[model samples]
Target: MRVLLVEDDQFHASYMEDVLAETLPEVTEIFHAMNGEEAEHEARALTIDAVVMDLRMSRRNGIDAARTLWMERPETRILFWSNYADEAYLRGIATIVPEDSAYGYLLKTAPRDRLKLALRAVLVEGQIMVDREIHRLQRRAASPRNTLDDSEFAVLLDLAIGLQDRIIAERRGMSLRTVQNRLLSLYEKLGVDDEASDAMPLNKRVRALNRALVTRTLNIETLETAQRDFDRWQSTRKRA
Candidate 1:
């Protein structure tokens, strides 16, 4: 079986290469990509049957790359070996994978045997494999459809980084009223009942955004993605 190993860390990739080579003798060809951008290109160019990819990368994130890849090739098996099993990652992956296709989400901290098992399960048996913690998080939390949607998460990102509704509207190419509507949805989904919280003097938006941050959902990676988007938006505005 041919597999693509997508990771930004060279050492980690090399080590993983060794592990895969030793454990999975059926894996004949193993290609490597340092980031999601390269991974995307490789996926299109090569005869890859499966992929072991990282979630967070500098150029493009694994979720976006996986989405693109699956858009083109839905049957290709994916094994997400990530440093974080963040809810964002979970939500993102949930939207992309084919309704019937099997996949895996094993943590970076997992044992070597666990990684081997995930690799085999995803690539060979075509079964779902999530880390214990990720499974616990998934079970403890609401289903992806029940949680925040992408539009609401986009609004949350703006609020997480202190963006006003007017600015978020402009950045997202939506009307201010539409942005406000999304915020209302976000508040309800996040359960940021500022009205009930007597201690929080701030408005619902501030409280809701803060709740996301405190829960470690809206983290630096989220902010960085938003910042990169802002930079692109600013550049486009300047040009226009």
Candidate 2:
């Protein structure tokens, strides 16, 4: 297996190269690039089996680079490494690529073992492995009470994860003003009037989104039926 690694930080780039070498001895060659521009250049120049990319970079971010690579070479696999598990990031990438292709997303803080598992899954099984936090963020973004449109929800998830408006706007293909307007509308709907107010901190909004997601997941009708079943089961056990 040949891999292309795209990361700006020297320490992280070196550490990942070491990890990949140690973990996958079968990997014959590993190519390195400091940014997305270099990554695209190298990717087009060679035939690589997979790419390990960092989403946040100085120029031509991972998503754009990945899109270019995927379009140019559909057979090559992509695995994203990001510090944040923002919903906008996930959805943005999803919109660009089909689900069946070999892809994965890992948080920068992911455990080594988990990272290994994700790589193996993508390389061998062609399965996408999302970091646990990312999975949680996705579920939260699908919540009902958020009352946000798909785009707005995506941006809100990014905001909740501490992404700046500019990054969110770029990822979502919206202008900065549009991003701000959507955020304002979302906050209003959530009854949050003041940006400076503590009533709607990022973490708090994330928690609410999570709760709403859980509630939606357990569909009210299903919850009622489950409750009834539990009540009956308890009564029967008591009688026995």
Candidate 3:
């Protein structure tokens, strides 16, 4: 099987190369790419059956690359290898993956055998795989399983995208008062100080967003997904 290895770190790239060579001997060609943009270019120019992608990188990330790659060819399988089993990453993965796509999310700390197994599952069996730890985090984050109700979470996404309360209410079919109330609840759940204290305004959404980001509740992938959704919503509204 021909594969594309997309990683930014030289050492990790070299390591992945060795793993591919040693573990999957049937893998005929392994293409190396430094970052997501390069990966996109190579994928467009080459015949890649599967891709082993790193989640974080400079310039562009694996999620962005994978989205574009799948857009180009939805049948290509993918293996996401990352050090972080972050819920944000898992959330982002959910948004970008094509319908009925075959993709695996494996931790970087996983053993070689585990890695090989996940690779084969995505590449051959067309199954989805996730590290148990990450899977638990995702499960725990789902509604009723954790804090933040759907309405409040919707407010969070709107806030993360820098939407005004009025616009958020309009988009979500909520009253302005209801939107503001949800934002307050979201702030409490996120442990953000949303009250005015002469230091910042009570409705300082920017500060709240920054706090959420530091807490890993809002990640780059989350932001990108939110932006995409917002853009689509805006476009649909325009047409209507």
Q: Is candidate 2 or candidate 3 better by TM-score?
A: 3
- Pick the winner on lDDT between candidates 2 and 3: 3
What tens-digit string does per-residue lDDT give for candidate 3 at 74-130? 999999999887767776777678899999998888888888788778876789888
TM-scores of all predicted structures: 0.73, 0.63, 0.81
Top of the candidates by TM-score: 3
Clashes of each: 0, 0, 0
Candidate 3: give the clashing pairs.
Answer: none
**Comparing candidate 1 with candidate 3, which one achieves the higher TM-score?**
3
- Sequence-dependent TM-score of model 1: 0.73
All candidates: CA RMSD in angstroms?
A: 4.6, 17.3, 3.6
Clashing pairs in 2: none
Best by lDDT: 3
Which tens-of-lDDT digit does each residue in 88-191 have in candidate 1?
Answer: 67666776799788789988888898888888888888998778978776557655544777788888888877788898998888999999999888787776
lDDT of 3 at 62: 85
List ranges where model 1 is wrong by over 4 Å: 137-191, 194-200, 219-240
lDDT of each: 0.82, 0.72, 0.83
Candidate order by lDDT, highest to lowest? 3, 1, 2
